[model samples]
Target: MPSQGKLYVVGIGPGCEEMLTLRARKVLESSDYVIGHRTYLNFVRHLVRGSIVESGMGREVERVKMAVELASGGHVVSLVSGGDPSVYGLASLVAELVYRNGLELDYEIVPGISALNSASPLFGSAISGDHAVISLSDLLTPWQVIERRLRKALEGDFVIAIYNPSSRRRAGNLRRAMEIVIEYRGDCFVGVAKNVCREGEQVLVMRASEVAESGVVDMHTLLIIPSTESIVDGNWIITPRGYSRKYELEVE
Candidate 1:
């Protein structure tokens, strides 16, 4: 088959049009079809002049397949995703599908700020040092593997940024992980940002033990467990870059 129109997998960045990257906005504006999850599609609905195709939860594969099929039919399709498309988003699936099906189509993965990035500013510099971005969701990855990774990250004393921490069906997952985290770093300072960069945005910073006790976290929250070395100065959190204690800065 002859080559088809380009497929731009654009990341809209944290459910806000203001946070959307310039390149991502341009790509979506020029696309012939905008495809994404219902939540993500709502973020870019005002910008999409083309056909808006959305899928329900647990229908990620269907969304990808539809985008690939549409682009294969010579439509300039924009596969929209919240946050960076390459980070646990739809870009990888789109690439994999195109490669496996031997589809002839030009495509681009436009990068955007991820949830962690959006939540970072709210927690000061807690992630200024080396940190691991781990998703607590075991829907795709096994729980055992996720536990192993958590253990390794804890052992390294690395700052950890957790995504998809909890949901209605998997409420105990975050609690279980918190147990492991406390065992390793019981007093580790934790910063939880809820609905980051969107409405109802709130930032809470407290001890890991508090997070383990509280049940406020949900799918929309982003958790940051900074190393024991991290300092909590007044209302700000900071992970120093080998700087002297007096030189450590604090900002909102």
Candidate 2:
């Protein structure tokens, strides 16, 4: 009997080949089977040689089950995800399936840059200060839970990075989010980055009020709501804590 192969949930990192970590590349290169959404697979198609298993959008449960089955049946499998696999990716789902199905297989999660990380640099590190990251998609999670987290983050005055802010079928979540944020911090700074680290990227720096007024964000856009201390310097928006002393003159 042939030895069963292990599984790896790999993060490809924000739709860019350069952003893919060395370890993720190695795992994909060694795998005999690769599974992921078509778009994610396209991002790393040149880096690996394997039988591809493409998952349709919103079919995460099926994808996880298939990847585990392949790995348990003696095929080294690589489950690819955009950005960090553990962050809004297949890591948790795969682990859950393993636990429920009693599949004994070795697996590891390979981390990669998330869209939030990629967007931060473009906006002058808007997330440097305390912040909260949340996903606005309510497919798997209830709206009440999402709203509760948003309210808590607002009360804490933490900068916020929100993912899946809107979609064609769910166009009003971003506007609602802005309304909630405004109730706590009126006219707060807000930055939106679409397709970060990829071609055709768009970045918008504006106020939370403006975001609600404009109504232009979508699921691809990553929204950053700055705290009270954030400031704009020309094209860059940053949150500085008056730490100039770290770079100022020394006492002579």
Candidate 3:
């Protein structure tokens, strides 16, 4: 029997070539086949000299299966993802398939700069503390459970980063999320980062109550909602990480 080829689950990272990790690039270059959603494939289209296997959204299973089959035939394959592959990406799906199907495959997950990491820098000190990362997309998870998680993040005063907050079908999810947040945080401060490091990248900051009026968030948008104490200091949004005032100047 021919030895099974290696499969690389790669994270493209922020859609920026420079932001792509060296390991990810090497894996892509070394692979005999490349596969992912069409949008994600375009991120490294120019770099892929291998066979292109692109598919539309909602076809993750088909794509991963194709990659596995190709690798099982003793050909190296790279399955691509937009952000860090392990975080809400194709890595978990591949793992599930491997275990369920008993695929004889050798694979490694290559981490990339996540969308949060891409968008977080635009947030300044907003990520300097503990936080929660949640996805508002109700495709796989129930909205009720998402609501509970949102409330938990609020009650714990966690800085929240919401992924897949809204799309054409779920246009109002982010709006409802903002409403839940306002009920607890009162006047909520938020930073909405869209298409970070990509063409037409935008970062918009505003109060949660004004999200609907902001006219900026969409499916690609990642929201960094601050804790209750966070504030806008000049051009920066800041979330305090419970640091004491030991550095404060003493008064006579």
**Using lDDT as the measure, which candidate wins?**
3
Candidate 1 to truth, TM:
0.93
Instruction: Give the residue spans of candidate 2 off by over 4 A.
Output: 212-215, 245-252
Candidate 3's TM-score reads 0.93
Summing lDDT over every window of 10 consecutive residues in candidate 3, give the lowest-scoring window: 241-250
Better-scoring candidate (lDDT), 1 or 3: 3
What are the lDDT figures for the candidates, one per model?
0.85, 0.85, 0.86
Winner on TM-score between 1 and 3 is 3
Ranking the candidates on TM-score from highest down gives 3, 2, 1
- Candidate 3, residue 91: CA error in Å? 0.9
Ten-residue region with minimum lDDT total, candidate 1: 243-252
Q: For residues 175-240, could you state the per-residue lDDT of candidate 2 as single tens digits?
A: 788889988888766888988877779888877878756656877789988877777665577877
